[model samples]
Target: MKRIIIASVAAAALVGGGTAFAVASDGTDSARSSSTAFQATAARASLSDAAHAALKAVPGTLDSIERDHGRWEADVLGQDGTWHEVTLDANAKVIDQRVDRDTDAEDAAEAKALRNADVSATEAARKASSGTVTSVEFDDDRTPVWEVETVTNHKERDLTVDAHSGKVTQAPADDDHGDDDSGDDD
Candidate 1:
């Protein structure tokens, strides 16, 4: 009876130890997930703020804006028909500005689209959805349109807004179209 009692206690202890280890590992995973979610939230907020700041500093049509390595970079077509590459700090402060004089065929196409656009980048983004705008650019369609990429509830979505009419539509999938370089680069 004494030996049986000792064996039962030892088995119970072994099972209990395994349970504790599993619980601890699960808790660590949960903590990591929480941390990652928090970082994404922070990045979304900063991107919006930085975009606004970039437009204010450059005072032109915003072509594209993206966050890279803790900084925000914006490509803007100035009112004077010049392209400006604006870089801002994480705090939305302007840090660098450069004029892109090397205009390629793609650049010319984008500029033409922007010129024909009745809606601004901000308006296109607003019409796209009530989500965090990650990037916005002109699509190389025959008709002027804006491609707005957004993130909502951790899901990414692509939307196209008519540059002339402000109409919004779902963007086409990669496989849905062929390499027809109609000047629309998504």
Candidate 2:
């Protein structure tokens, strides 16, 4: 009788452990499916749509818009003379917005550049490539250009379009991940 009881308990524990493992595996699969769905939705989003959504939500002048980490982020100069950071979901829905209290000279310069830019973000994206635009931001490089990122055939391409002349050029690869190989902090 004692031996039978021990065997029964052991079998029950093994079955319970297997059931738990199956449940955990299903949970992982569900999470993966949800993530894939989100990426698909984000892929359908366009720079134009995200810009419109951000502007509508914040009621401000769009300084820059970029798709980062599966969401759309926009920097805008509010009518109140304050900078704002707006985050939008994959569907271009405003998810969160915050005032940029730590405004700096760079922010002002970007705004000024946007005001003087002859090529609109939409225009730059159109001229840059036929790929899906992921980001559009004005870079105040020596020549001043609109840096655009796009995904074509599952590959990311970075191009710079002249802010004034609308000329497009392939941007040099940015392999430096803050390594500072030159050993110069400045």
Candidate 3:
């Protein structure tokens, strides 16, 4: 009788453990499925019929879709040598639109100007003393500025460039300039 009782208890524990493992596995799978379904739903909701139609209208091809700043953006190139940036909502509804001759062209130009200015500034600083470029950044209000941190033989320097003009305007006398103090710091 004692042996039978012990066997029954051991069997019960084994069965219970197996059941618990199965339940845990099922829970994990369910959670994963739910997460995937949610993502799909969100993607579908982000675009509206009109937005979809607009995207299809773009000439070249649908290059890519991305989420930026809580908005959906589609990159499309028109047959007329124009790049269209379509912003949409979570429901795929068109929120805003932009047409650029070339995407990132403006930014590239700005960056080039900035780099040239940096080179010029660095040369000037070298003339004065030796220094290294640490970092570059824009200023408040999206001003394209190069915040250059240079460790000169004499001192560290910080420089700001104008986003529109790509000109180096100011340089800090000290290298202790902190990180980008932008509103998006958080």
Q: Which residue runs does candidate 3 get wrong by more than 4 Å?
A: 1-54, 102-186
Best by TM-score: 2
What TM-score number comes out for model 2? 0.69
Please tell me which model should have the higher lDDT, number 1 or number 2.
Answer: 2
lDDT of each: 0.72, 0.75, 0.44
Error of model 3, residue 131, in angstroms:
48
* Predicted candidate 2 versus true structure: per-residue lDDT over 46-133, tens digit per residue: 7898999988888866767998766789988777768899998867888999998997888778777777888877789889866988
TM-score for each of the candidates? 0.65, 0.69, 0.29
lDDT tens digits by residue: candidate 3, 23-130: 112334355433311111223342224235545656443333444433466655455546677777645677677786555666445434443342322232223232
Model 1 score (lDDT): 0.72
Ranking by TM-score: 2, 1, 3
lDDT of 1 by residue, 1-186 (tens): 544554555445443322111111233535543331111112323555777888788777888776665567889988887899999875778899889989898888888778778987778878886587777777655788888888788788988999899999998876645667656677
TM-score of 1: 0.65
